[model samples]
Target: MAKFRLLPDEQLARSPFKQLWREFSRQHSAIAGLLIFSLFFLLVLLSAVLTPHDPYLQNDSLLLLPPSWSQQGLVQYPFGTDDLGRDLFSRLLVGARYTFGIAMITVMGALVMGLLLGTLAGMTKGLKSSVLNHLLDLALTIPSLLLAIIIVAILGPGLQNTTWAIMLALLPQFVHGIRNAIAEQLNQDYVIAYRLDGANNWQVFSRIILPNIWEKLTLMATMALSTATLDIAALGFLGLGAQAPTAEWGAMIADSLDLIYIAPVSVAIPGLLIFLAVLSVNLVGDGLRNAAKKRREN
Candidate 1:
């Protein structure tokens, strides 16, 4: 009998997660983005406990105070006070909960709904699929923010309404992307083999289709998350999202517009937070897409 030899660790197959990480780790910007995003997520989780003062509490005497080290600043307020004299640091910490939290929820909701609808459109025949494609095209032609604004205008402005509006506006992009991906995959040789091998639509989709298209789906998710974050901020800035006393970053910026010359830090801080959040998400998405492309080429 021939002797069998064990394969070396380097020659062994790595799990998908490990493989993706191996690819992703090579990108320095992705790692930095992940770190920044984690920091924002941590702030969201710890907002209630980490806040130095009640985000909503007002101190008329402390209005427009600068950062703690500034001549007019107080030790109790590290980032300073807003026009309402509320602790800027505290409100920003709490604001992460509203801004990032809402975007996360909206993206997830859109993803799930889009996946279902896209699958339906992809697996169906001529007329139904054509109709869906047409509808999706119409939705896509309208800018997401514009679509969201239209929805919010009809629903009446509020945080909850904003979330719903963003989710709906985002739905078309996810649906369109996923539908195209599935359509492309369906034309592959392996997909035909699966069909010939008696695999049902559900089985093919859940197994081969999903596994092959997962990278695309992930890229779409990250992009959607960034879009949702920006859309929420825009709506809030327009006074149509988070209402008064909400501590949302967009609303905070809007609230501080009048103080731009007098207490610019108040507006700048929130604007910076929004910029950082969007930038980090986009960086991670770009990194993932690059890594996935590399993996494919290899």
Candidate 2:
């Protein structure tokens, strides 16, 4: 009798979810990131119900207090107050909701826009492909942030415009990634096999090529989500994102800049939250990329 195990081909053909989970779980930093992100996002969701004070409430008499532990700080406003006495703690929590929510919406918009454009270009050949490729190449000449700023300027500054601008700016990269991924899949043996087996274009693409390229799409989506967060924050800081009265991390940071000396925590808290949000997204992206890589290597 001989002991037997599945060969690489058999293993690769097995259900992907278990393998993906196994690879993803191997990354300790990613697990830590998931926990951190969950905690913060939960705070964002629960902030409205849990806040001790209204984030927008202003009390001139209690303005610019430091953290409660600090000498001049008040106990009730544990996290402190800004130049205008808005609750730093409450605003920070609410800002998380606004910032993450906006980023998600922007990423989803970009995903759909990119996929359509990329698939159209990638699936075509000759003149049509050349035209679309040239268009995307021309669009890529300018940096995304610069393009976003220009778009915001043209569209007029506000949350909706800023979101659209960020999505538009991020679309090029996603399109490029998707186009290249599909182009590569089109050359692979599986696709050729399906084509030769009397499978129509739709059947081959929808059944084989799209499924194979899904991992790349997932990676692009995560990267797009993180990029959207940064772009939104940048726009907010420049006064082009969410308007005043909206609780957003970058906007909060801008409002608190003048009080950095009097109460640095006001600036620091929002800044840290933004940083953490980006970090968590990147960590998860890294885990997914690594997992995908591991599968490919195996």
Task: Name the best candidate (by lDDT).
Answer: 1
TM-score: model 1 vs. ground truth: 0.95
- lDDT (Cα, 0-100) at 47 in candidate 2: 80
Q: Give one digit per residue, the lDDT tens place, for model 1 in 125-149.
A: 8898899889998899999999999
- Work out the TM-score per prediction: 0.95, 0.91
Worst 10 residues of 2 by lDDT: 8-17
The global Cα lDDT (0 to 1) of model 1 is 0.91
| Alpha-carbon RMSD, candidate 2 | 2.8
The most accurate candidate by TM-score is 1
Off by over 4 Å in 2: 1-13
RMSD each, Å: 1.7, 2.8
